[model samples]
Target: MSQPSPQPDRAAGHNPRSSGPGRLIIALYAVFVVGSLSRAGFQIATRFQEAPLAYTLSALAGVIYVVAAISLALPGPRAWWVSLAAISTELVGVLAVGLWSTLDPAAFPDATVWSGFGRGYLYIPLVLPVVGLWWLWSTRPGTVQD
Candidate 1:
């Protein structure tokens, strides 16, 4: 008798990122994308001459959030790495922007999404990346599962 062809892997449907708590991470990122972009758009359009740096930074933060959310929701190794990079970038951005804004308040007459360590957003921008990085590390493929 001819040997039967092996069945397709059943685990193909499993997506570690978006299967559980990752959903919450993606959701939060989505909210940030909307909030930051909206603020940036309004500021840039209404008064670009007033706080161009702050408005531009807000727009950049919004774009980062969009990348983070999409990568977190997608499946596979590439997406995981993209998510990692995005989250790491976000953390650094928040820290640098926060410190800069704090030490040199004159540099940022208006707040960006990450100004004062996301103080304007209740620090969600500060905390979200930490949580996202933790989640990515914990859910990485090849980990021993129960």
Candidate 2:
């Protein structure tokens, strides 16, 4: 008679690799995803014609945030790569839009998610992408893989 094999520890819902900061990051990303998407929906539905460029940009940012959030929540190398790409694009978008809005207020006329470095959101939009990129890099294969 052989002894039974021990089941893998699954005490918490969280994966072993996704404790602490990783979970926190994921939660924040989820919040941003929802916020961006909701804002974009409102902007596009209510007054898209008023500032087409800004509204379009808002929509794009929302999509990117959603993708990044989902990718980060998933567990795999592919997800990591996708999240990295999304976050990098987000960083570039925020920087470019922030500078453009600052240099020429008339150009915006209406604010996008990246306008003024996301001042409306207290610059979290600007900083989030940087943190996300770092997190993804840290979780890369051959690294911690979290």
Candidate achieving the largest lDDT: 1
Worst ten-residue run, lDDT, model 2?
A: 8-17
Model 2 clash tally, residue pairs: 0
- Cα RMSD (Å) between model 1 and the true structure? 4.0
lDDT of 1 by residue, 1-146 (tens): 99988753426755678867889999999999999999899999999899999999999999999999999988777888999999999999999999999999999989999999999889999999999999999878667252
lDDT of 1 at 11: 62
- The residue pairs in collision within model 1 are none
Residue lDDT tens for model 2, 1-146: 99988754433332422455667777877787788788888988998888888888888988888888778777666677888898999999999999999999888889988999999889998988888887777767555622
Clashes of each: 0, 0
TM-score of each: 0.90, 0.84
* Reference-based lDDT, residue 37, model 2: 80
Task: Please list the residue runs of candidate 1 whose C-alpha ends up more than 4 Å from where it truly belongs after superposition.
Answer: 1-13, 144-146
